[model samples]
Target: MAGNPVVTDWTTDFDHTDKAWAADPYPIMDELRDTCPVAHSDRFGGAWLPTRHEDVSAIANDTEHFTSRSIVVSEHRPPMELAPEGIAPPISSDPPFHAQARRMLLPVFSPQTIDKLEPSTRAYCQELLAALQGKDVVDAAADYAAHIPVRVIANMLGLPEEDGDKFRGFVLHVLEGVALPLEERIVGFQQLFEYLMPQINDRVANPKDDLISFLLASELDGKPLDPFHVVRTVALLLIAGIDTTWSAIGASIWHLAKSPTDLKRLVNEPELMPTAIEELLRAYAPVTMARLVKEDFEFQGCPMKAEDWVLLSFPAANRDPAFFENPDEVILDRSPNRHAAFGLGIHRCAGSHLARMEMRVALEEWVKVYPDFSLEDAGAVRWSGGQVRGPRVLPIQVGP
Candidate 1:
């Protein structure tokens, strides 16, 4: 965040980590979607930005031209051979093997499984809200939104809930620290696996009723999963699960705090909560996934070179006018909406069900407790840089 150069032209020399992009990328994306839908940049060892929904979907579905070898766009690309089971399983894995890896994890994220987590997730949301009581103004993001997923994921991974701070540190370094020096970044990544190794080893010796243990007991290709595979998958769960959902929840609360009409509607018509949640997700979709060009080829008039980074902007796609009605507007009851907030194609977020449940419960609890809230200082609300965007420092007045 500190060392990245300022972006001169979003279309040509784009840097997703730039302050302007993080503050408000919709305008930037809208411009690109119209003028240069497949914008190219030389940064991050060359990268492409496709703001159109169709292009994003095409590239996401086309595994032959792009590989998930390195989902994060940075100076250091993971080796080409890492594919089929990239650093992380499923999300980072490519086809054939991607299907097998993804299929194995499907049972863990099935709706039935997530439904079982809702009660505790809701209770955790209530617990967070309880702490905000009697305060005129509160940091909605730090105090409420950020903690929900941390607790939920910690419980799932069989880790100590109090280690939320550590988890946050890991997420930040992995997601937002893309521009850091390669050596420093490597050390940061090592720390995460180092922390998880003991937990994984403990599960191996004394298996428990958690995801780590489940993976250990599980088989891949008719053989037990390797220890490192278990570690990488667990790392994926920790990193992916916390950051994206936290952003979604925080962004939703940020929206409600500013839009009284929408807030009042959800409060008055409780049944609209489900529909409204999707609307929020579409309007403020947080994640932008990255892929490496498999080989040099032309795409939508652009000559993409092999190993070039392609940032599949799901947030931008969700706002493409070609795909949705009044793409820029947030219509709570927008039924038949097919926004790709979770993502498109094979690598779509696996924990989407759990994410939705977290967002719904978090919003419901917040609104139930503080029905009338507004942005305390719009200027003070800080949005995170890099792929995932959200209100990281949202301050809201508790009541009207």
Candidate 2:
């Protein structure tokens, strides 16, 4: 990553993994939205970044032109035969198949279902805070924000909470390992499957009240789901479910750490939590999805080819001046906030309800305890370097 070439022109050549983009992509995205609107790059085996909300929404909704076969943009492209079901369903599923796959899990992540987990989620947050009692400064990203979703999702999947380190390793390899060598990446996938196959087998043999067992018992077209399908879906639940929410929580904390006024308002105005959560999600939205161009075609005058990667940036779309009022400013109670933080179209995040619950509870409990805190070292805060972006090393000063 260090030796990668510097970007001379954002319109002609842009690299999401580049240090500049990783550190602060807002400016780059804003400039792209103004000038190019649709920026292309040779990196990641040729990819395009559509900065405008209209284009992003169009591409996201047009399954006929784009394929979800491989959502994460990387050097490696999945074989053509993998489609219809893709590597993971329903995120990776396409068209009619995607609908069925997604419908099966709706009840699992429904509002009612996620609400039941709130008590335990709050308990865990309190436990985490309890452990940090004497700390004057803390790494919020690593110490606090990162653990909530991992614990919640781990519990949902019936995996041991102590196996969190392993889950983080798999998440890093899958989401942030875009620039990794193909062979190395394959090994990462192999390692994840190796670790999961055993758990999956155990669930198959002995059913439980968790997602894995639920998937194992599920059927498609009146036939039981395949073992590989179960593994892929579980991996999706564990990887996507954990990283996106973790990043959202960390980014929200990072914003409060820097903006004392916003932090103070949140502490004093307890009723503003719901609106504040949506505003934060709109402004610092994480998880930029990828879609492989279905076939060679021109979109908004840019020549695209089959198998090309489209970096569908919900973050960029959320900030587009054409969409939101004074988009850059984080207004806590911005009304009509129908932003695509959870994405747009049929692929809108199924885990959004769960993510919202986690963030609200996490922030509520955090501000209730440490109502006044600031960044310990602005320079020391480190952000992740791939599609899913957030503060990975956020040091906050909690006491004088």
lDDT of 1 by residue, 1-400 (tens): 8787898888899999999999999999999999999998998889999999999999999999999988988889987778779999988888889898888888999999999999999888888888777889999989988999999999999999999999999999999999999998999999999999999999999999999999999899999999899999999999999989999999998988888999899999989999999999999999999999988999988999999999999999999999998998888999888989999888889999999999999888888998888999999999998999988999999965
Cα lDDT tens digits for candidate 2, 143-163: 998999999999999999999
C-alpha lDDT of residue 171 in model 1: 95
TM per model? Answer: 0.99, 0.99
lDDT of 2 at 312: 97
- Whole-model Cα lDDT of every candidate shown, in order: 0.92, 0.93
Candidate 2's C-alpha runs over 4 A off are none
Any idea how many clashes model 1 has? 0
Error of 1 at 4 (Å): 1.9
